[model samples]
Target: MRLLLKKKSVVLAVLLLVGGLYLINHSDFLMAGLSRSPEIHPSELTWQGQLLVSKESWVDRGQYLPLNVSYQLLAGAPATEQRYLSIGISSVNRKKGSYLISTLQSIFSMSSSEERSSMVVVVLLADFDTGWRMATLKDIKTTFALELEQGQLVVIHVPLEFYPPITGLKRNYNDAPERVTFRSKQNLDYAFLIHYCAGLGQYYLQLEDDISCAKNFLSSIRNRVAEQEKQKVTWATLEFSVLGYIGKLYKSGHLPLLARFLFLFYQEMPCDWLLTHFKLVMTQKATILFKPSLFQHMGTFSSFQGRHNKLKDKDFDDGFYTNPVAEVFSNISTYQKNFPNLAWDAGEAFFWGLSPVKGSYLTVVFKEPAVVTWIFVETGSGTKDLLQSAQVELGHDVVTTGKDKSCKDFQSVGAIENGKFEMQEVDKKYSSASKCLRILVTATQKHWVIIRKIRVTTKQSAPRQE
Candidate 1:
């Protein structure tokens, strides 16, 4: 009886052990599901169909005037030692010249008076006739009377008769088939204007006649400029709008080269296409592009007949789903702390550093794993250890530490501009399951590196696994 009882006890112990092991393994699988957050795949936040571009040009520019003699100075902005200049080019043949009014109006409405006051709004008159241009100038003088008198409004007339004729521009109309619609001449027009206003101020803004702007665009420009200086990266241009060549900003110093480049390639490609290619000609890649596009393309009418303006019907919505700035970055590796803290948002000051030992970086952590589309890094102008080179890496399934931790594991951002900030748009969106973005300051030499602003734009979505 004792033997039987002992055997029963042994059997009971074995059964209990097996039951405990089973529960342990199964519970862990169930718990994992409960803890996991819903994954919003990057694929889900994408566009379908052919991508679109906005190409608006004055179709009648070729038949009319000489750019040189025609570049008549209608009005000049009051000179007050302004640091920047916003240029708006108005051509002939468009309706009402309402773009001139709207561009200036938007500037006044969104930016501070001081900023508006400092900007020189040069409206180029490339109309079909002198009468039309004169009439339009009269309308502008009357409408922007205050600005005109204050030296904030400038109107220039570049009539066909006096301006230089389209000469020396080599072309492959087949490249930009739109050349059939006089798109090549339109390209030349932009080249001339950009060259014309090349060194008018410390900075030149490429403002179009038929584009609308976001609120605080001026502030955005100013902030970006300041950040670039603070961040200490050598940059070339600050691109405001992603649609075509509407709101492109350039360093006055680089204008001559850029303008000349446009001159050489005017006939080969559209102005918008020229912008990206032009960057490659010089920097091997395009400069920083502002996300959530500060300026939107609103023109529905195509400047080139038969080619309708398709910016309105983009296959996907390209607005920024994430804010350019965040309150604080989570799981930062290390940062330089001093007066004037790092600016994570667009308007803030910047993050400055000096003698950062090897492997120092500014990290941006998100609440959940996300797909990052862009990272805008603006460096400040300081002499010590300026960020000469850098690399950006995305982390997935990581906590404070991340996988793929080497600079080689990341991508190299192109050359930094001298005494300015550089913006790098990811060619392809990066998905991070760990929800962290690591910007490794992999290279810096001499002087302090000032990162005035580091903006990480992300979509709060990720792909989940079984």
Candidate 2:
């Protein structure tokens, strides 16, 4: 009897715990925790509060900072005027590849001359190592000589005065755990670079020293931002990459204010952690993330001491170098002609927006009924932009003015948000109903879908993917 009672009591306790977890997850309890977070609507900020933050009383000052940093402007000049975007990269002791030069090359290679001149690469040689500093400068001077002379690559030598003067507060958490400090000086470095390059570009793009960009990454960003604007959404920061602050694109206008906000918490948190609080206090807008990650962290070695490092995303590394696309058909659907100016071309191998109207799809008409063996498709670049279900319809003939009154069985394709969307080979090859087949798409949302490349294969002919 005693044993039975004990067992029953334990079971009841477990049930109560599970019920509590369910309520917390599914009900208003979590909202209580959310309410305490710092996010505030943009309208809630007052001019006085935005402008005036007393630095003296807010936090403890940083200590054991670099005494002096030898100043060197190896290349480029200040922004002539506020440009479209400013990419701020902190090239610390990344003993890996020529991430600095290669990143610049990657940008310039993908971009047209006009696009290249539209923004500036603010490279901050921010480290205390003398040898690394000089080598970094020499390399930048040699590799990007033209960009340096053309004012496209702006390299700045960060000095001791740029940081808070020597104080008692800890700056490295690993070195001094008892006092208030950060994981690494990197938090301070980003704060320094972001503030320094605030007025340089209309929008500031935070990039890591050891990172690679995706193919047409900038174009992707421009399209995403423009789409959000079209939808009248107020976004906080647009994240181009998945890693913490890396790939985070901030409006240069907002960066100045955001930089000021971080100045108050400089000693307490990591740059990324600081961003969370900063977003809470400053704006209610949510951060926009780029799918498949535009920027990839290549540095295996951590710049900070006593830390383990791993790939930001172990599965996804595809971008400018490896991202390949197959050929697409020239014919887009003639039925739905919306946003014709920003029309999607099969050969363009990029973004395509859809209309809110149901049955909005892109179709290609084949000369003969395609005995489709395998169909390859790269869908939306975002979470919601992905197709929920794509109806693969095939028909040889159809009525134009009136309904054909024939129900067609089509292959329904579905997908999760994988970097590149490739559907499985159908159980059996699909032959067109009459002679033409249509890829009828149903979107999860009205956002654009990126059909980078679609290759259809048949038994008789080669797959025309490329």
Candidate 3:
């Protein structure tokens, strides 16, 4: 009887030991579940539930501090898998209006289908208003259903408890108390957003909720990054726009460093200022700005109540110039190297010409006729050097005289007003394909003329069916 009792006790002890080992081995996987609360370590941020923070987020700040903040995945799954790029945008409820929806629309609309596939856009709804956050999420889901389904867009929110005390911050810049509080909170918002996006991709891009994207902006950014990589240029930040915190790109591996810097001095300065400081500390002495900015600010009202912001990027190009094969001829005296062809070329430089009198003309004759669909022309970067008055004309039937080619007849399409002219889906007045497009000056002006941009879209007529 004593030997049978001993065997039973030994078997029960062995079974208990095996169960303990199994639970210990799988504890991390179980605790990291989306539904379960995660175990917190004072020195490290746990990858819990929908929060996909990676283990590499451990930063070596002089002293270790616990980050008790947590994020709620409001929409779309976090991109745990690596992507080519990750875009981070933080939005708050504005007093006057909201630009988040428009910003999202512009990003997806401007990016190509393939470009969208290689990147992830993470939107942090950093608003404290629960109702507003819910409404915004619904709007985004409804408007961007396709993008969300394709895993290109992910939306998230931080509960109020996640933020440290925002009020009663030190006024380092001698700013107003409300302004100080606003900037301080903004700092924390960006820090949390940066940290969250650190592990989503190979690179990260920082954008705002109130901006418009240029056409094929993603491709332009990728090309620039590739150029830098090929040249072996060690850079910390690549700027695509000059506007505050608009189009900044960083490497994913370096994001933890950036997030730590932002977290350490979040209360001392605004996010933009901190960005400059961060760049300096990283040993990047010069600001690398890509010309013909890929993004532009579209919001007039500030996120902070009652303050109006009307900033615009002067170098932003909408990628309109799609002129068909043609030869450009202009009678206006060229300014230095700013030739007539430079205006139509797919580049940032524009054509600068001396002051023009009435009847001065610039003409583009296509090698083959096309069904012209769209034409856009912009003059002068500033008010002083504008083409005061001009008329846009479409020419039909080409004729050769001497060594020069000319249009047989020209019909008025539209006139340049306020130094700008744009027409899409032009009414085809002629029955046949058009031969040329022209700009004829109607009024003389004292200031030099700057043909800043000329864009045309054309489609050939379908082959006639026999």
Candidate 4:
């Protein structure tokens, strides 16, 4: 009797152990079904297709979750027909402030009518907060009714099932668990966004939600694409801003592979670093960055919680300056006939002046009273021929008193230290319109001066955003 009881107990223990192993192996599948909303049918998932997993360690079938994801169209739907360009922007709740509306305004207002017709702007609400998503979509729909009706704007959101286990991810580079989770989720977000926008247009432009666009930026991108075609260069990414993943453009045809790559290694690195690897794997060896960047970062708060950053792209051409018609004059003698006007004009030859004594000045007098906004002056070609000591001043109430037709009354705005000076908002001190901009030599200098650039912007020339 005792031997028989012992056999039965052993059999029961073995069965329990086997059952527990099976449940552990299939926990994700069982939990996924139980936790999913009843409204979501199997067919409603975003990507129905299955990706064949490789035996590689990075993509081990048992380690990574399945690629089947789900999403919802909260607002505008995608156009049926293809477009010339597709602009992808991803947004999340920031701790400090929201810049999504301003970013949308910038893109829509900066793009020309024809440019708008040629492209589609897709906004992905990457945050999972249901209330926040609804509120954001409401704001977007209300603000861009015409654009939504015209099929130029779209809003998409990935359902909760879109992500894998984001928390407690293997910390690479000794990153904190929170940072790892943030970047890992970011990678997944970008992957989902890239996959969604893959077939929407001929090219895909990745942009952040806290950026301002330059005027006619779409036209500039088209021109850059045309130039690439003319050169017959096989490129992966055409960068319009140096900031992280703000203005990166890629061929639409290659987006699928790029998306898959990101999804596979979502936990390993950030989205931008993954992009670099993707570019290299595609046989494009170098980053193709364009000058006069078309986007600028305007967010003071980062999307990552509890972090603050103030990032700006120096190359961004904000289109504040029309370089309005003006006459240039200088007291320093000219070199090789490189007149002072040459520095202000849109040309290669700058204002090359000989050695200057104290009180020598280079002046630019506008044809009308101008509300100056921004000024940037570069006074050196190389280590030599630099304006060693100078100060920039705003001249008001001008009378054509000098022989070169310069202004007389001046107020010091800023000084030229280290051969360069840049200032914004010249109207802060003097609300009245200014007559001229003058760069005066503070002290005598033996080295000749090369006014490499003199970029000026005014309020009247800047485009007003509605």
Candidate 5:
């Protein structure tokens, strides 16, 4: 009886252990299903059709032009219940002498049977003739109305200068006067337009008049909307003239005057970098999505003259460096310069550091033209001492004058240049082993070193992986 009881107890214990392990391994899958279950019914059909649209045609200044556009659906059913489409037009009228009277017409036509979604285009015009600004606005409104009436497309006219003010501006910063008023106006307009679209349960897209739509742009956007309802992305400005980081930072509800003053003084970092660093924080708290590539620019402007019409020459000083090493070093330097008070390893700031353990780390690996860097860590006898002497290998060997061979066998290949291993007593029966290691190697220009796998080995066998 005692032996039977013991066997039953052991079996029950094993069952519980196995059940716990199963839950641990499958937790992510269960959570994903709970969080991202499809909102739309599977039986509901999606729009899967293509429409080829021409680029905006230029009209003579002071002319009220009627744009006759037609949409012939390539596939899918034009069902009234599921289809939602809105169109808008925008133009620029600020340049002198040679001005372009560009007209944009959007048709949000989608079929019910399609799988992919459709996109709405927002046209942007640059270098407009300043002399005929009102004429340009009138032309745009007229063209927009005409397209709506003729094509039966729901249309909204968004003047680039029209925006509801956030509030009556108080003189907060001294540099306010030097800022470009028109640029601010445009940004405000875009913000208001996006908010307006959101309020109406519509997705607003901004596009340049010069870019012709791919035959299936609208269809694609519609499909994307169906797949992900929370695609409410705030588009970044296409013009890089704006300078301000986009992200969240934690602070006391009531900060000391000194802390507030310091924060206000140092908040001019690039927006995308800030967004990337604090993506998790912002996503959780603010419910904002910063779509980095939503605003695609045709090309860099030769010179961008603000409202003052003075020519501004901008230089691209940060030449692209290959991969993780370059990105890590650049991000560290940028953070150090921009955010001096914040520790690099703390909170979301870990996303922007030399040894970034949080978030996704991307490194570009190349075969020929190697770049090398020495990596170090600390470990020692004391807790602080135990952390002092640990270092790891990073980078690749240098290639001279010939076609360099690719190091395909290793994800990251390097040798530990320095440090010694020591075994120290923790308690009477227990001991810990420590090693101070450094690595030296050359990184090929095109090869990438993704730090996806990290391991520490004391002997040929039984290496501990991290």
Candidate 6:
């Protein structure tokens, strides 16, 4: 009887120990896996006041910050008891549409102040397919107006179509559900949004329905903008598309004149595409903030222009020059004939190519005599090879130089073990008072390539003659 009792006690103790271990492991999995929670070090955290400077504190170039600034957290506790901004999402879907929202929520939940100040996820509706979209939209205004805790700013996402009519503006919807046609109406919408946001906050972020903010997107944008602003970049476009070769334009040194003519004569092309190309030619760098106002001003839908097609009589109209491709080519040809040394790549037909001016994110600083640098990150071993094979040339005459130009050859600096090749000081020369530099990379034995990132840095003075 004593032996039997001892056996029973041993079995019970073992069962209890196993159960405790299982619970501990499960708890860790929940916190690390399902929650996707960011780790917070309580000891390392500190609070800082919001940073704001006067417009005059920066330069007066065309650069200006948005008018709305604030954010909120729909979930999670205040990691630190610091005053910060708030951004809220008014809708969430649980069905197929929810995938994006869920992903967004996950990203927001994991975001850090080092990335974004603060963010909130207001689940206005659980299922968007259940006819709750309209109701969700309607409630955003009241939710936004709700006073936040002290020391916090609130930024609301208010749908523009639901708002009341503003006096003195006429709305046109000729391009409904397909294209953006009414320039005045689009501008008016932006004006109203800006004005409304101005009353509520210091900076406004107007995101489109399709855009998915990356975890570090806000932080990246803020840091990039702050750096550019410090350098006094008046006009910045993030994404740049190649128009064509610009050697012809560089030869004539008449890019500004040609661009002016193209802008005036060709008003019908896609503004975003055209502006991006222009940035590539002039600044050799393209950057623009992804915001509703910018979209309204630039985004247009035209099924007639899908991918690349040769210019034809059928495609020509009063807006022929307005088309991004047509306008870009026209400008490229004109600039090429005049400048001749500006080489550009329009990208291949299959590839959408790089945007000279359009950026998924961007910032602008109102300053003068700024410096800019363009950095391109090559991804994939084959892509790096291709980049290495291509030669870059910088010259004053676009029409006269080709692959044989003295400043066209690129030398390999080093190869990254991760399949990337580094090239530095490929071609540098001083002509007149302007400095010219070019970098070219091409694949020696591979096809199909990917670029990781392209960085452009602009500086004002010549490094103090050091």
Best by lDDT: 3
Among all windows of ten consecutive residues in candidate 3, which has the lowest summed lDDT?
A: 38-47
lDDT of 3 by residue, 1-466 (tens): 9999999999999999999999999886544422344333323222333545545544523324434456766677765587888999999998877777767866876677899998999998887776787678777886678888888998876766556678888888798889988888888888888878877888899999988777788888889999989988668999999999999999886776787678788788889889999889888888999998989887768999847997999988755323567888888999999998777876678889999999998888887787665577889987768899999998877777665566878989999999988664463343347788889999888789999878765555432232
In terms of TM-score, which candidate is stronger, 2 or 5? 2
Please give, for residues 1-466, the per-residue lDDT of candidate 1 as tens digits. Answer: 9999999999999999999999998895545423433322232221111101111112122322222212445555435444477575756565322345544555555566777766777666655465666666665665568778877776664435332335444455544344522555666666656655544567788867665556567767778788777976657667777666777787766665665566666566677777777677656443776665677554445555523464732321223212433224422223445332244543444665564444666565555655554455556665543566655566544333343222223434443454333232232333333344555655545556666655443434554352
lDDT of each: 0.54, 0.54, 0.79, 0.78, 0.27, 0.29
Tell me the deviation in Å of residue 417 in model 6: 35
Residue-wise C-alpha lDDT for candidate 2, range 1-466, written one tens digit per residue: 9999999999999999999899978775344323322222233221111111112222212312212222345456765666677888887664433345555655655566777778788887776666676676776676568777887887765545445533456555544653343333566667656766656766778887656556566677778778877977666677767677778887665664565556556667677878877666656456666676777664446555424467675423352432112112322232243322122233333535543234655444444443443445555555554545555554433223242222233345434235244332231334332333344544444544444545443323322231
Error of 6 at 304 (Å): 16
Off by over 4 Å in 5: 1-92, 96-134, 137-146, 150-180, 199-201, 208-212, 227-296, 299-466
Worst 10 residues of 1 by lDDT: 46-55
Tell me how far the alpha carbon of residue 112 in candidate 6 is from the true structure, in angstroms, after superposition. 1.0
How close to the true structure is residue 364 of candidate 5, measured as C-alpha lDDT?
Answer: 25
lDDT for predicted candidate 3 compared with the true structure: 0.79
Which residue pairs collide, candidate 4?
none
Quick one: how many clashes does candidate 6 have?
A: 84
| TM agreement with the true structure for every prediction | 0.49, 0.51, 0.61, 0.61, 0.28, 0.27
As a TM-score, model 2 comes out at: 0.51
What value does the lDDT take at residue 248 in candidate 3? 98
lDDT of 4 at 235: 87
Output the worst ten-in-a-row residue range by lDDT, candidate 4. Answer: 48-57
Residue 355 displacement (Å), model 6: 40
How far out, in Å, is residue 315 in model 1? 13
